[model samples]
Target: MSFEFVGKFLPYFNDGLIITLMISACVVLIGTLLGTLIALAKLSKIHVLRWLANIYIEIFRGTPMLVQIMIGFQLLGKIPLPEFQLGILTEDLSRLVPGIIVLSMNSGAYVAEIVRGGINAVPKGQTEAAYSLGIRPTATMFKVILPQAIRNILPALGNEFVTIIKDSSLLATIGVMELYNGAQTTSSTTYQSLSPWLLVAVYYFVVTFITSRLINLLEKKLGKGYTK
Candidate 1:
């Protein structure tokens, strides 16, 4: 409601926005990579690998992210890490590192399921054909199966990216200075609680909305060749 107040703190929000995007980008890349490996492990013939992957996925997916962030912060904070600056962002590796790690781990669990489902959706004959040509199982999975599986799961992966953007707010609890923390700081300083939050909500909506539209466009472009 207070446009003037919101305008005054826009730069602070922008800074927080940068951190949020950075965290989400790291989580998406790391989570997807970790998830894909977990998915492959889950689909492996090795019983020990399947069991370990199942346990990892279950533990991360079953727990709350906030708790994970808090615990990870405490545990990882013990390790000594040097702080550095990245332009507008001051890298507090103690908090930022744990926040990104916990988020990536949590995200990896859900992405693992998405990837597993995508792999399952692929036709079995594809693998059979690859194997018939004397392709090793690993080669068949990497070369023949994962590409198709990734295509099938693009929308789901996009959703995961959006989710990470929103969920990055949790990092604020441990003082990582993300968007929500910026709002909180503004509210504490300006003595207007609702306006800062409202403005932050708009910021979140704009980012997520634009991201969703971009993902949709990418999906369409990717699907064009398959369309009749």
Candidate 2:
């Protein structure tokens, strides 16, 4: 509200914003990779692969991400995990891993659909031409189809990245200390709930706004190359 409150609170919010960005970056990278594989499975000629992919995509895409996170986080404690030699990844890291996994799994389902649509958008003739030239199916898909498909879907993927940023706040429920959690901490400590939540909301808006603009510019650039 007031400039003084803004000055006092911005630093705490910035710290949380950084963590949110870091988590989103990790989620997007892992999610996009996993999603692409799932999409490929969905498109594969193999029946079992397609069925498994469908199951994964359906379960993840159908469930709420928050529920997914809570389930994963709770299950983590019950499972026996191997200790890491690095020791850097201790209890806190253990807590974070589940949240990241949940986010990636959730995002992958949506990204799979985007990727499949993008792959389908490529003309049939292109695949036929690649086959005619003796390109193996895998090679054709990886070398030709995927590249073009990614270009078509880049904007959607960027939007996914933005969405992940906002969704990362959900990790706070499990104590990830992301933007929302940071605000919650501030509110509890300062006893001024409105100011902290307001600041974090502004932070989310700024991050998403900037990200959307960059995505738009990238879409335009990629479009220029593909125009007939």
Candidate 3:
């Protein structure tokens, strides 16, 4: 039999796309914040904090995100156990929240290292110079160290966004209807393999490519002033 996608199903894919973008945006935002903190902790002077940060980074960065998602949901199930109702942990939480949590946690680990390296790469003289001006440690970090580090980390952070976008596909396992899942449902109904997925791939490529181009433009702008 011939295949076709009805306009009604169009909404499914569209809504799926929206959910995908939403999840990606949330993951990126949460990931960046947590990642920045992790990066700072990794660079901390205290041994225990640095060691724990390193382990967190290693475990997440070293393992696949899919594994993290699975383990997170499972652990969520066992959390607080029967002893504590801990109604805070519910089944619905496993469906979408866990995806976000896992994505952010995993992405944060990698982004942390990137951020740490970026901060370290900033000249030590800059930090000392800021301190010489009587700037507080926090002020120096934000105004001097972090500003320069962000300039260096922009490209890598952009890559992290792209990775989060792609990793969202794993959400389907938990009933999150993202692009890949949308395409799968459509293909199942239409019985046509490549056409549905080809369109899906194009959508992904277009979104990622446009974002990448923007990143390049920002990189150039930032690099120019820094080079001066």
Candidate 4:
């Protein structure tokens, strides 16, 4: 409400923003890579691989991400594996690993569907032509199919990026100290819930708005290449 309150809460929220961005960046990279593999598997000639990929996508996509985060956090920490015993994955930083995994798995499910659709949208003639020219199946997929599929799917992936940015706020529920968590903490300590929450909303708006605009520009740029 007051400018003083706004100024006071900005610092904490800003720190939270950094964490949110870090998580989002990792999620996008991991999700996109895993999702592409899942999509390819779903399209495979082999039945078993296709079944397994479908099961993964359906389970993750069908469930709530919040539940997945909680379960993953608990399950990953209790694996009793070598990595768990290693210094690299102490209990203090363990939660973050699961958080990233949960986010990646959730995002991967959606991305898999997007990729599958994009690949399907590519013309069959393109693959046939590539084959006629003596291109290997793998080469045809990587060079010709995926390239165009990426173009078609870029906008959708941008939308997913934006969605993940906002969704990162949900990590606050697990004490990840993202924007929402920071605001919650500040509100509790300062008893200025109204101002802290409003400010967090503004921060979300600004980041998502800028990202959406950038995505629009990228779409136009990619579209130009396709049209030509």
Candidate 2 residues lying further than 4 Å off, grouped into runs, are 1-9, 77-91
Question: Pairs clashing in candidate 1?
Answer: none
Supply the TM-score for candidate 3. Answer: 0.88
Q: Could you give candidate 1's per-residue lDDT for residues 28-140 as a string of tens digits?
A: 99999999999989988999999999999999988899999999999997778777664444657788899999999999999999999999999999999999999999899
Q: Between 1 and 3, whose TM-score is larger?
A: 1
Better candidate by lDDT, 1 or 4: 1
What lDDT tens digits, residue by residue, belong to model 2 across residues 38-132? 99999999999999999999999888889999999998845555433211111256667788999999999999999999999999898999999
User: Highest lDDT, which number?
Assistant: 1
As a whole number from 0 to 100, the lDDT of residue 94 in candidate 4 is 58
For residues 1-228, what per-residue lDDT tens digits would candidate 4 score against the true structure? 544655666667777787778889999999999999999999999999999999999999899989998999788855543322221112234566778889999999999999999999998999999999999999999999998898889989999999999998877666666778778877887887588888888999999999989988988887884751
Q: What is the TM-score of each candidate against the true structure?
A: 0.94, 0.90, 0.88, 0.91
Per-residue CA lDDT of model 3 for 133-156, tens digit only, reads 999988998888998998889999
Query: What is the C-alpha local distance difference test score of candidate 4?
Result: 0.84
Better lDDT candidate (1, 3): 1
Best by TM-score: 1
lDDT of 1 at 133: 100
lDDT of 2 at 87: 17
